[model samples]
Target: MAGVGVKDLLSADDIDESDLFDVLSKAAAIADGKLPARTRPRMIGLFFEQESTRTRIGFDVAASRLRHHIVDISASPGSRLGKAQGEDLEDHIRTISEYCDLIVARTEHVATVEEIARLTHLPVVNGGNGIGEHPTQALVDLFTIERRLGDVRGLSVALSCDPTARHALSFMKLLALRPPRRFTLCLAPETKLSNVAAAAIDDLRRCGTIIDRVDNVEATLDHDVLSIQTQRASSIISGRIGEMDTAQKIEDEKFTLTAEKVLRNRSKTMIMNPLPRHSETDKSCDSLPNAAYFDQVRLSVPIRMAVLSRMLAGRRWAGRSPSRSQPGWPETSSPISSSLSRSVN
Candidate 1:
């Protein structure tokens, strides 16, 4: 399969269906230790402007497995940054890309990722951009779903809470590229969905997906997969912090994924979350059979390893002995990740 270049991952929509599947297929082989293990000196530069656990750690671990050097930078208030000193974002990107092979960024502004890609020669992987898109997270999430349910094409999913979640938009984008059997967005009427999210829904509809918007929790819980995302506006904005009640309509105590809902689905259903929760999903669900979010977290390492290997070790992946075992590859799996510095494996 042809490789995804620097510009192919700026947005979820930017990913080609074939290349996306190739990434995913490579991810699965890497996950099972069937693919060539990546080796070092390959570097990935990271720039983050927000707090993250999985996005940061996952990419770091993945890069380590791929044998890459990772450099991290956080654009926080106390960090010494040219941008902090009134430098333009483009200048920062230009200066950093000189020394790095790849750039991974997590910022509230999608334009930051785009600008970095435009200014730098390195591959820029979007971690999360406000309510824009979390492409890597979507990759692992889809991998977990495929691992659990066999095929996503005929499955049903209920995307609940946080209409503005970038990961949610990415997930929807992935679904549209292929599609689930049926999918529903379970969000409050007042919930703000991003333009990307709206476009993803429209794309899914065009792909013959049975997609719906539901307000009723009971109706929303009936799907085969239940994915939860945190409210970006409430988490990122200072005025919205600790205001979960106002930001989300799901009840703090009762609206959670209780054992009741899991049992009601009857058929095995999975629940997923994109970390740093603010009372939308219950903590107890972590131990349940339905919790695939942790599995999604687990797949992040190998998938990222595959991505980094493909990007920096192109000659290695190309010249290495061919493994005919990876069948029907490009249409199957996709994965990616990020860090706060230059660390990438």
Candidate 2:
């Protein structure tokens, strides 16, 4: 199989159908100890502006297994680059690029991640850039789906998640490249998907995938795979965050899934979640035969290790080469006060 032919993992567009298949295959090979691991340990910068559990740990463990060193950094009051210190993001990125072989970053704003990539020549991996994209998780997810159900070409998938969740958007965009047999979205009735989310659905349609939108989770039980998360019920009930009335509770429950609902519907769909879950998925559903999330998280290690090895060895991915090449923003003395910096601010 060919490599993931790109300089960085910035977005889903960085990969296509063939590249995704190769990644899944490579991950499987790595898991079985059949692939060569990176020999020389390089310094990796794992920077995050957002709180995370799995993505942060998964990359750490994967680096250890592949024999790389991670320089962990996060946005906090004590952080030299954080708002508390009022340090410039670009200056911090420039200093780190000199020390690290590559950088993996997760930020509250997609602009921050893009800025980092633009400021350095070091290979950059996008680790969930706000609600914009989370291509790495998207890759792990498709790997999990294929491992569970063989091929995704003809499978039907239902997504019950925050319409703007980074992982969900990336997952749907990746799915568009392959065009599943059916794609259903279970959204809170009052929710409006972002233009990015809607664009992914349109891409699916243009590529011949069947699309369906429903307001309830149970209505999508018949799909072959259900990738779910907490719905936006609070947004529907107007202003209050801490207050939940009977009507809001009722609205929230409609988008949640339970063992009873699956059994009552007699649906054999494989259930998946990019966890750190809330009430959307009941605890009872964890023991059900259809639950695949635990295994999905477990698979994260191997997939990440595979990706790291591929990138470290200077392997080229099979995806199309980017038509445009941007090598950092042009130097200006007043760069911090520039137009680009304000957009992210």
Candidate 3:
């Protein structure tokens, strides 16, 4: 058994820039079918406590591609093995760990996944943890950005969503660790940065990331990358029938990414949505060249395959030397470079 240095991928804070880049590179190779197949079969457990489509399917496909047998364990509140059924989470995790080589868990609370990691000797991958962090999503998002835009450093990235969204927080946390020189992060009006996020923002600033809080969605559109996160309160629901009404009510046109806006800045900006989108992103914009949101979904398999392979193989990343000099921005610079440059100071 190869010992991948890290035991589990519970948070974005668990990985650094070098490891991130290396995984992405490996992902590209995996997508191209260049990587060799697994020598032996492994059993992977998919333990989802919340409703999901993308993350679950992506992991399932990734595991299958790597020749791993997947055992799906759905433990939603009302299900047979759910907490409501009198099953203890720790006991469930321990039992699952004994049968599976790896466990990918999505739960209602961050502490749930944390406890899963604590109790299990087997490696745990956080699929999505309540309002905490979705490290895998962040990895796929970064990979998509780098693939489409060429690089992540020095690009202006606007994360428009409710401040408490876990995916947004995880993305920001990852960026903070390996901040780009002269990078910009634009926050939506409703976003209230958590204390931890605020500290990360401070670190980004010190590392030369220009941070901006904007009221209008249009204000964020002029940047190099636009990432929209759908509001979670409206998205997560308990009952099946009542969810449609709630989802409809939460679709706000004000935050919608319209075709008109995409046309105006299509050449300069890349549009991204961490999916299951409501009215936040217009369907018409899907056909546009700069729309990388769907591509993010397409790339998730390879990215996840790379992640699982590394964790299972115990591969370690060679770290990069710290640099104080400003990194060069990508050749395809944003049109509003002058204004963006001023915002950095």
Candidate 4:
């Protein structure tokens, strides 16, 4: 599987629609055990300044399955990232540049990943960065969307989430690329969308995606997919929810979904979440056939394998670093990027 253009997977916007579909296709190939073998194994670094559950384990297993070695450095003391060790990011990156072929970083600030990119020519992947983006998770979600719905084209989607959350923002950014026929935001009453969130939805409209914002979750009942998540106090403390970093939660029951609610709607809308869910999704909802969140986890390995495999293409740190413009994953060799990667106007 080849990569989508852009030097690093720092933001969802770095790759366009074709790049997303390409990675999804590669995931399918890897699942079927048809992935081509690499000439040699390389070391992959997973540096996390923030705590994680799924993403960390998922990438670790994916890297192992592909036969490469993994070098994990977490915020246990922040020493690996140089925070606890009284070292700056540049010094730490320089140390790892010699040992790793690629780096996957999760930071409290998106700027950290951008900084790592600037410090070295090595390929970098954003595990999760502030409220900015979790590009890989967004890609995994797109894969699940297609699996359940058959396709993304012309489908209606509704998102009920903390609009400023990293995972949510990345998902919206990616959805913009595929251009759903209609995109809806089912927000709780009084909950507000951030300026950056509004800008992202506007990008979808640029691709002809019809947009709507409703105060009720049921309003999303007719959409082909409903992606749900919310911000809570823990999120504020971690600073993953937004810049305000203030305590907040969308507690309105009207915004939450239950098994009975799904049964009542009976609209074939698939339910999803980037989980460790909250009150918004009742435990009862897990029993419903429409629950694809867990299945989303099931697809994580291959989605990640596809990403790791592609990002490692033509990458090595031992050799003299190449220009950042010359990406490890070859740019789309056709007109797909130029035609589909336009920025929001």
Highest lDDT, which number? 2
The sequence of per-residue lDDT tens digits that candidate 4 reaches over residues 236-300 is: 52655575523335457777888888889786889999876767788888888888999888788
Q: Candidate 2: TM-score?
A: 0.84
- Looking at model 3, which ten-residue stretch has the lowest summed lDDT? 323-332
lDDT of 3 by residue, 132-223 (tens): 67889998988888777766786888776754566776787777755654444443333344554565556677778876665446667678
Models ranked on lDDT: 2, 4, 3, 1
Tens digits of lDDT, candidate 2, 1-345? 333366677777777666676777889988777856449788889988767789999999988888889997555556788565467888888888899987899876656788888888877888877656788888888889888897888899998887667788778878886788988888655556665566677778788887777777888888999998767422321223455443235337777899999999998999998886667888899999999999889999888887777667676455532321322211101211111111100
Q: Give per-residue lDDT, candidate 3, residue 45.
A: 90
For candidate 2, what is the lDDT?
0.75
List runs of model 1 lying over 4 Å from the truth.
Answer: 1-8, 37-40, 76-79, 83-88, 190-193, 231-239, 242-255, 264-267, 313-345
Clashing pairs in 3: 3-314, 4-314
All-Cα superposition RMSD per candidate = 10.4, 8.7, 7.6, 7.9
TM-score of predicted structure 4: 0.83
lDDT of each: 0.65, 0.75, 0.70, 0.73
Stronger candidate by lDDT (3 vs 4): 4
Best by TM-score: 2
- Regions of candidate 4 where Cα sits further than 4 Å from its true position: 1-5, 75-85, 231-250, 315-345
